[model samples]
Target: MIRKDRAVVWGRFVRTRSGLRHHHPMTRKIEEAQPTWFRLSEESWNEIREAYRNGATAKELAVRWKVSPSSIYRHAWEGGWSKKRSADADARAHAEAIAEEERADQTRPDPEAGLFGPPGADDEAMLGDPAALAEQAMAASVRAMRARLFVEAEKLARLSEAYGRMAEKRGGPAVTIETIDLETLYDIVMNKDGRVGERFRVDPDDPGPRDPILVRYWSHRYAEREAFKEQIRRVRANARKAACRAVGLDPDAPLPGF
Candidate 1:
């Protein structure tokens, strides 16, 4: 029950009823009809601000906290939270890409494993037999060549897909080739035979047909793979010749080709 001396204006009781002279229930309800403004505690506001700066969107925060997006955006603006969001988002994307690449590297099969050696072919046991060594060497070389080509083709497919996506963007940065590692380039040059080097040589000086960077990397890698394979062939052939002479057979005899 309200005292006769007190009057209610809006929701609060006033000492004087100067303007609101009559205390009618209907008038009091109408005056107090406005909804209360939503507010967050200081601690909750700080948490929201930190989340916004750390790459969380205002809409996401609103849904998660059961609050309106306007409220989150308001606090975000007042607290200067928008500037860091894009930077944090980029950093998160970079980190995720690095993690995905590491995982792929871990799961990928090693292309160079057993390239020069046939499965279950003992080099020592075959040393006494010239024909056996020659056949094994040829089969091993064929298998190694096929493996290398398969890996190169897989890389090219993936590179093509990536470039296709990049092409969809207008006014995007031009695709750039990375500098070849000096040590790796040196190794490729040193291992090169006349045939492989001439066929797959990577000429950075070439001006026309500006292919993507990954295509250039693929060429360099293919050249290196072929050069290494050639070196293995020569080494294996010499070993077979030595074994033929040791077994009292003709060293210069033509080896059987697969």
Candidate 2:
């Protein structure tokens, strides 16, 4: 039996009257009075130790277990729990993130398929011949570029025509310039005429001798289009040379089946 003010600490009751005392076994000190805080059961204390070792913070465990954070820290120190649990948690999280990124990469779409379109049965058949594979890749790349150029050129023409109509309403020239069709522009650019200069020429400062704003707009876009085409050309050339070198062939020599 115990009084209201008297309580048990470690199964030893506090004194109900003066001059009666209890002592701690390890500390070997006479107990002054029952502490204000409550004690956790052995099972709960064991769980707290395990949680602390596995990266749970003392304050977090204290809140969850309804104990003082100081008690949690004291118990951890007594139990020899590692203080480097936070660092271990961070390392674990970093490893998981890297694994997740690798998993995402495995499921990601291929850029080559997106750009040059999916390979056909014939392209699959050319896998054994590196030079043939390189040629096929280049051909696919050129076809894709041509298709994109046609679409963009048509869009530019429509924009130019719309601008012309708007100009007419403002009492200006009805059309700023003649809108060239995609085929005519392709021929003019590909033929390398003096007016065009080169196949992949990109001179921003000089939109050429053409006076029309249409030519200037086309010139700007053409430079961008040619830049992409040149990149493809360079990539193909390099890939072909690499393929040749891999087979112990002369890289500077003419490519096979050229």
Candidate 3:
């Protein structure tokens, strides 16, 4: 059996641990019995308003004020305290909206600009300006033409290489030198409906004809090209994931690519 004094001490200790005190029950009873209207000093109310305006959360303000977060919210609501309007916020939203509109506009080709210009208007525009403007326009046109020619030349070079390889494999007649209709030939070669063979009337025994071997070679080449494209796509995806991981983001989480 425990001593009476020790038992009382132990009970008091337990009550204290459980957050009960001598005045707790009486205070609760008194509060329940009485009508209450809480009031605060003007300074205290100003401090609360300032805390809310400065972005201190209600819960944080409650901790500082020794009150519940809900009480802080109720007081703020009742006292008409609210977040202050920020000029920066308005500016940022406006800028974002403008940027979005610009991005959308970029996808649509304007008839007055670049490759989408009216059919015969571009040449006249290039020639119609003051000396400097005309010179600049001519320079731009020349640059564009040069770029197009370079691309065509590069494509012809690749086709010539392919033809050379084919000729070497066949061990037939040497490749004769002539200007090739490269764009037309490229379209024909890439066509799926056997249109190239039909257009050229390529008989099995005809000389300098594109044969099944050439078609099979190009088919394999296309497959390899697709595989390369897939590889590039995978590489870009992995790079994005790695970047996200570096910034403490979940790599597997869905994200807007744009």
RMSD of each: 28.5, 24.3, 25.5
**Tens digit of lDDT per residue, candidate 2, span 20-43?**
445432331223222226667999
C-alpha displacement of 132 in model 3, angstroms? Answer: 52
Output the better candidate (2/3) by TM-score.
2
Given candidate 2, what's the lDDT at residue 99? 100
Ranking by lDDT: 2, 1, 3
Model 3 lDDT tens row, 140-223: 444445556555444444444555555455564443324546776577559747887565443567566475767676788779
lDDT of 1 at 58: 65
Please give, for residues 147-225, the per-residue lDDT of candidate 1 as tens digits: 7766644544444444444444433544323566776566666865565455555578877564466588787788999
Please rank every candidate by TM-score, starting with the best.
2, 1, 3
Candidate 1: residue 95 lDDT (0-100): 100
Off by over 4 Å in 3: 1-38, 84-258
- lDDT score, candidate 1: 0.63
Return the TM-score for each candidate structure. 0.23, 0.26, 0.22
| Candidate no. 3 TM-score | 0.22
CA deviation > 4 Å runs, candidate 1: 1-81, 111-121, 127-131, 144-258
Per-candidate clashes, comma-separated: 0, 0, 0
Decoy 1 TM-score against native:
0.23
